[model samples]
Target chain A: MSGAGVRFDGEAPAAGEEPQSTATLAAVAEAAGVSASTVSKVLNGRSDVSPATRARVQDLLREHGYRRRGGGARQSPLLDLVFHELGSAWAMEVIRGVENVAREERLGVVLSESAGRLTPGQTWVEDVLARRPAGVILVLSDLSADQRAQFTGRGIPFVVLDPAGDLAEDVPSIGATNWQGGLAATRHLVGLGHRRIAVVGGPPTMMCSRARIDGYRAALGVAGLPVDPGLIREGDFHHEAGYAAGRELLALSDRPTAVFTGNDLQALGLYEAARELGLRIPEDLSVVGFDDLPVARWIGPPLTTVRQPLTEMAEAAARLVLDLGRGNAPVTRRVELATSLVTRSSTAPPPGS
Target chain B: MSGAGVRFDGEAPAAGEEPQSTATLAAVAEAAGVSASTVSKVLNGRSDVSPATRARVQDLLREHGYRRRGGGARQSPLLDLVFHELGSAWAMEVIRGVENVAREERLGVVLSESAGRLTPGQTWVEDVLARRPAGVILVLSDLSADQRAQFTGRGIPFVVLDPAGDLAEDVPSIGATNWQGGLAATRHLVGLGHRRIAVVGGPPTMMCSRARIDGYRAALGVAGLPVDPGLIREGDFHHEAGYAAGRELLALSDRPTAVFTGNDLQALGLYEAARELGLRIPEDLSVVGFDDLPVARWIGPPLTTVRQPLTEMAEAAARLVLDLGRGNAPVTRRVELATSLVTRSSTAPPPGS
Candidate 1:
């Protein structure tokens, strides 16, 4: 009972209780008078299974206590994708990626938002368990220790996307090369001969934001330039924060020639701030952003920024979770896709260059 | 046998066959060995019910043929919100509204995309029925007669938001006042002394678009201005269409001083077209858009447009459907919220005036 492939009577054993007999797939199929593949299909909630046949197979499985290796019921034909917030183009990009894969796998995707919190409340876990989705993908969020254990105990696979905090090595996660993205953005500005550069970053607590700021500093260090403490500002990753940060940076006695933002929304706000002060982009103040969202190109003086492959990252997370759900272990627990710089009209040689 | 609240034994009666006895709430509670409130909560999939207790109550309900007044099984405490596409800020606004109400009600939301089709495919209904959500809200889409009947037969209430076509009086719907919105936009331009106003509207087949175009014509008639056939263009409601139409209109020898677009995305494209042709906003060409989205203010020279209360409309739709799920019929089958003009930097007196 302590080993894999355990079985029991009609009633599921109580938590912490071990059963005696172990039921094999072949044994269960033989007892149910069905092929092993048919049993598997029923367990996977495939649509091809006839209602009566599925009911019969489910009853037989329950009676034999045929647990699928680990502890949990059959996987429902749905996947849950939770986001920190669902009100941005960035979220839409990730959703489209997940939907592409989910559609191909004939799985429905459920979208949830944590309502601007770091993670969903305790009831979110209960809801996920009740639905029994095939897997869960949480973007910019993490599960608590207890929640993680519950999912592990139930053999529910979950993958984190762009985790907001330090992720344990054992946890499966997908993210972009934030450090390299930051380095690349700063290097591009350096190449344009702008030594006086300012940084407008996201929450000081977020891991990704810290990584990006570190990259910016690393670039400066490599260039043998001094890091100006007054030039760095940290705030939430939103437009209003960007506007405020930009105003402060622009009002400096010796203002920086270029500004780098944590994300594109902030870059837009910076544009507003500059406009209010009667400054022209590229000519008066060069600006760079990250996350190269769709609107990055649509905005006036198409933004030059770091391109994070949001869609690809989401797709990878979806694929990894689905593979795990299919009883296949991941080759690696952590996957980080590359990021690059997208040069547009927003950046040019600094004033008086 | 055919009366309301009828129940049967373990076997569900064949379609068209009616049962003789109706299992009362007391009988279901007694058989399941739970209080009436507990049974009711279990039937509604309330989070308060323990898993074991819920399973027991569900089994008993099936054995006793106990169901709500309508034909379907108990609600799943989940609501499905299907969108034509989830790749826009507009969708996000609606989702936020629905989530606000759903959070308060302690109901989970399931978001789905119809993938740009007019309606979800045939299998969508089956998949939805399998989940057994309390109700469904469709944005800019409609169900066929057969699909509507299927939901009706299953006791699942559905409401349409911003319906793309003519909805039957019996179908509940939520929409903005498109005619009034269009009227206000055109009147703003007319009041600015722009007699040669050009209209870039959406597809002729969409009812809302038609209403908007009609409103434009009505405004011109009220001002004793002749409708300029040459200035009217109709296409899909998107950026590319607006850009193409703007180019065509601007290419004309007798170009209008101002242009009014069906939506904000199209308005943005018009801005690009005007910029590429060396025209300045308000100074050279006044532009008025509809659906004052978030970007309307963010764009250079904030767009003067019609305010379509999308979030409020979505909230209203969600509230209506939840009421229907709770056995309350809507006070009105169709609800149209008000739309108003938002004057910003985009519109001004025609250049010469």
Candidate 2:
């Protein structure tokens, strides 16, 4: 408690400037009133340190911008790929992408799930520090500022894949052009004379989903069609959510002729809803989906979707983290890969056109 | 080559007996004409050793049945889960299963794909050796006898999940009752008054497919129906294969009224083929699938299939391997979980009945 506000010998760099005076381990230890070995143990993620002491030391380390130099040779030949949750073919594609890079680099991939949380647990960060992987790639997951400082202090680089929420501008992230994909999907349906098109957006909390809905609204505006609030449904990105939302929308007196489910899994749910309502695809109801997961092509009538290139995005994230680990700064910290419209049998002209 | 057949100072254990008098590392090194440090390097998967020397040293270690004692402290907190090919909802189920066990045990999961190969590559084995995971869980994949010997020499334990091919009797494995599942599937179709039933089995090389087909045959035999050779289609367990087989089977002059697709993906393919032919599910034709993947419930008509309990099976495999690593020999090295029939809207009485 006495060391809480003590000024350290090190200073943090100015915004947008490279760190010029990273304090050594001994300086941080002296300022925190601990032995250098204690600071070393904390950096190594040893569990022997008490939570109170660990937090105090971590705060001092961050305040001093203390980064260990030349720890690359000591790093384990591994990369951590953390996910918010592990379900669906979407994850499988991402896993394959990371596996590709891991194989090429001869590094083992450590797979962990945050168990549906937006960020990994404290224990996960501890385990990661102990193993000391070359880098980390997070999919739809973020870290608390303290957790971020912990990794930064250890010289461990991380890249976010498809960030679920707003991130600091300094954090490197890879994403698809979700807004553009949404616009293209809506424009395609509009071109097919579907004036009353419905949009089933994923969880509004997710930035990707929000961007997509914004694009949907933009497309309608560009096409000179008034955006109908009644036709927009907010649903979680899952099959059940899509099913419930679909059932409600289809049961309306004036239902839309086409529906744009935010993702492919939700689109499948919508498919079931349409099936139960005796609606034949493209005949009575047209549908579009995003992600273009492999199942998108296998389902009956095949889904018309925006190809998000999930695997490529994952590969890019893996590469970026590795590059950062090797001290190779990227030209840009934020990147959005191209998303293309894939036309299939699920979309058609409005009935009796 | 002079070290090829030279007998070392170690005696292999008798069949069905525990190993006795395990040779020392120094003895193996001397027998292989290498220094003890070189032999230790080989054990640690260090790449400095020449390939020839590495193979020679490994052979000597296996001949001696050498086991490193008290290396648990040095082992990384990891469990390796290798897949023959990372695809589909099937792999996802298995990954989730292993993750559950790993999370509880406070172990990190290292995932690898063999890229469609029945066995993982040599490089993968070397990396696994270097990482020294607590245990290994292999999915639909096998290892060469030499590879197995190497792991055994290092006191590493592994378990197979859903064995794709024949395995040695002593090899521990976890699987579902594929034969019984097939029998139940066919019996359900028969009970629905489908006398002319077609069977679309997975690859003949996979023991699961063979067992399932055999069960189908047994069910038909018990029902006093002759096994129609022309109605059995040998296809791989994939959507495209199902589509091709479905096209062929449906094109028969006297097409079968119902089909038992070996897996869910193939069933989806069959659905596409049926839709193309203007046949409605459960009315014009009946369908059955296996594995009971999440998509099975989401697809149109909600596929009637066999629930293989893949996640449970994977959990069992992971637990078994961990138990083995702790020298807790299981009562049996082979375990098969039960598979049950999940009846849905995909089956019905004959249209003319």
Q: All candidates' TM-scores?
A: 0.82, 0.91
- Candidates' C-alpha lDDT: 0.80, 0.86
Expressed as tens digits, the lDDT of each residue in A1-353 for candidate 1 is 01112111111222332333234556768887888778665554444667677667766766775554533334456778998887887888898888888777656687788878886776677667656677899999888765665465456789999988887777899999999999999999999999999999999878999999999999999999999999999999888888999999999899999999999999989999998888899899999999998778777878999999999999999998877766676789798999999999999999987
Q: Give lDDT: candidate 1, residue B268.
A: 83
* Candidate 1, residue A179: how far the Cα is off, in Å: 0.9
| Per-model root-mean-square deviation over C-alphas | 12.8, 8.0
- lDDT tens readout by residue for model 1, B217-280: 9999999999989999998878888889899998899898999899998888898898789988
Model 1, residue A92: distance off in Å is 1.4
Best by TM-score: 2
lDDT for each residue of candidate 2 in A251-326, tens digit (9 for 90 to 100): 9999999999899999999999998999999799999999999999998879999999998998899888888887
In CAPRI terms, model 2 is classed as acceptable
> Which pairs of residues clash in candidate 2, taking residues 3 or more apart in a chain or in different chains?
none
Q: DockQ of all candidates, in order?
A: 0.15, 0.32
Best by DockQ: 2
| Interface RMSD of candidate number 1 | 14.2
